[model samples]
Target: MRLRKPKLVLIDLDGTLVDSVPDLAYCVDEMMKALGRAPWGEETVRGWVGNGVDRLVMRALTNTLWDDPEDDEFEAAHPIFMKLYAENTSGRSCLYAGVVEGIDYLKGEGLKVGCVTNKAAAFTVPLLKAMGIYEKFDIVVSGDTTPKKKPDPMPLLHAANQLGVKAENCLMVGDSMHDVEAARNAGFQVVCVPYGYNHGVDIREAGPDAVIDSLAELKNLLK
Candidate 1:
């Protein structure tokens, strides 16, 4: 079968573009320290990511129990996480292998590229900038940039709108079920990479249009 060329490509950040768990875990550790709590491991932080900073903090604070915190506690913790994350944003962060080349190849093919990540804007921008790939995308929509995040389809739909592409003409590339579900709901095609944070679930179980071992393989699909 002939492959289709997407008019627009929407991508996820954490676990998709960058293996950002190190820095994220550092922030979580810092926040926990500030609150007089024990620090969690990097693996724990990876499972907590792919949602947003608030959810990540909530997960970290609850030690993976995912319990709901009171409004005041959540409010206080949010800024602390943000502050800690901002301070250690790029210290140990790096783009996933093949990500830069894949994005460059997509742009060379004349496709509009956008980022639709659940990471908050404050963290997203600095991380991307530090990776030197912030300018690669035509648009960057963070978790708080829209009313709804992934699995709601609103963020992906909004990204499609910004790229001037119909949802059906776009391809969403991410590492989590949230991206697949969001794309499915928005009527866009999707492909998932195996090496992303999928909440400890198998990425194949998420049921994306295609599963690739590396970002570079994406070019073969477009061939």
Candidate 2:
């Protein structure tokens, strides 16, 4: 399929630009410990991400899809996880390979860019700044930026609106079904990477416009 040249690019945070699960895992485990619950390790936490922190906490607490933790228990654990996560956000999180070069290429092409992630602004902003990519995005749409998050398309559409670009002229680059569904619903093109979390499913099953092994290859595709 022929791809449109994007006027703006919206990128996902966790599992797309940065592998943030290590720090997220640490916070999840810490929160569990404080709650007198067994800790879910990093590997398990990897599959529970991309949904947003509250959902992540829910998954960590329940350890299965049937996450019906007691409200009081969840409320107490939530703030603890938030505090630990704020402290651990970027210490072990690093940009995946080719991310920097890809960002440079996007900028060189003069495309407006935004970061739209389910991660809350409290963690997203500091993590991006610490990783030296905060300034790369013209706008950063956190989970709380809009009333709804991915798969609903509000955040992606909101990012395009903020960049003053029409949704059809935007491209969303990410690694999960959430990104693909968001871009599709927003009327934007989406490209997925093979190596990131997709709830333990193959990302190709989500049917992105293209599947790239690394962000560096995006330059060639865009060219």
Per-residue alpha-carbon lDDT of candidate 1 for residues 1-223, written as tens digits (9 for 90 to 100): 2247899999999999999999989988888888888999897788887777778888876766468777787787788988778798888988899998889899999999999898879888999999999999999999899988898999999988876899879999999998999999999899999888888889889888898877787789888
Which candidate tops TM-score? 2
Number of backbone-clashing residue pairs for each candidate, in the order shown: 0, 0
lDDT, candidate 2, 81-140, per-residue tens = 988998899999999999999988999999898899988899999999999999999999
Runs off by more than 4 Å, candidate 2: none
In candidate 2, position 121 carries an lDDT of: 91
Q: What is the TM-score of each candidate against the true structure?
A: 0.94, 0.96
Candidate with maximal lDDT: 2
- Flag regions of model 1 displaced more than 4 Å: 1-3
